[model samples]
Target: MNEELRHQAYAQLEADADRIVRLIKVQMDNLTMPQCPVYEEVLDTQMYGLSKEVNFAVRLGLVDAEDGRELLEKLEVEVSKVHDLYMQEEKLESKEI
Candidate 1:
């Protein structure tokens, strides 16, 4: 693949990951609902969309299943770091009292 196209692929994969995260949050929140007809449809659509993007990305060599897993791991690590930073800030602010 051309270098520019490879970069494009990376950007696309990143966007897809962001979208998947949002959809998952929606799914989780909806699980607490008593009865939500739209929940299932929304989840199903998001899932199918994610699968399609993954398939395309894999076929194009932008990301394999292992690569996807690695990306998710990195995402988790980043989120954890942010959470820890927030907690530390809260602690420091509390100490200022």
Candidate 2:
């Protein structure tokens, strides 16, 4: 694989990951709670799309399999952190109410 192509693939994947994070953040801020069915559906769809992208890149020799897996793992951790924050806030609000 050409070095430039490899670099572009990796960059694009990272960018896609960032876009998903932003989307999740927007949903988290202005839409349904994390545990809502709609929220879960969106998250699942986005994650599945990203996983397919990663698999495609790996098959094309543009990205390593482990690297793609790690990317997904890191994104999951980030989403969890965001969800946890919202959960904690919900708890506090409930207590106040």
Candidate 3:
């Protein structure tokens, strides 16, 4: 793939990661314990896939390390944000009980 195409794919993958994080947060907010285990497994799988894609893209010269790092950093930020939001929601829910 061309550089532009590779970048676009990276963006899509990042979005997918963010979306998965959001879904996990939603599941957590509702106190869904059984689903949390499944979500954790899925998150691990997706993270591995994303890491492989980053390596492949860099190796193929579709993207440089700096570019890949930036994308990964963005993903990290999104994941952190979602986790924080979920924790806050959980705290609020607990207070209501």
Candidate 4:
């Protein structure tokens, strides 16, 4: 692949990862609680979709395997942080009540 194509692929992957993180943040902020089954379902769907996208890119040789792994890892960490924050807020609400 040309250098520009490789760069674009990587950038697109990064943007998708960022979009997932933002979605998690928004979901936590305004939608169901983290413990809700709906929340779990949404999270699972989003993660699975992103993984499929990464796999497709890897198979196409648009992105390196290691980079794809890293992208997923980083997104996982970010989503974890969002979940943690919601959990913490729940705890604080319970304590206040």
Q: Where does model 3 exceed 4 Å of error?
A: 1-3, 22-35
Kindly list the per-residue Cα lDDT of model 2 for residues 7-32, writing each as its tens digit: 89989999999899889989988999
**Deviation (Å) of 54 in candidate 2:** 0.4
Ranking by lDDT: 2, 4, 3, 1
- Model 2 TM-score? 0.94
Q: What's the lDDT for residue 80 in model 3?
A: 71
16-62 per-residue lDDT for model 3 (tens digits)? 66776676666666656423777677666767777788888789777
| Predicted candidate 4 versus true structure: per-residue lDDT over 12-88, tens digit per residue | 88998898888878888998888889888988998899899999999999999999999999999889988888899
TM-score between candidate 1 and the true structure: 0.48
| Candidate 4: pairs in clash | none
Q: Report lDDT per candidate.
A: 0.61, 0.94, 0.71, 0.90
* Model 3 TM-score (2 dp): 0.71
Candidate 1 stretches greater than 4 Å from native? 1-7, 15-56, 59-62
Worst 10 residues of 3 by lDDT: 26-35
Over 4 Å off, model 4? none
At residue 65, candidate 1 shows an lDDT of 72
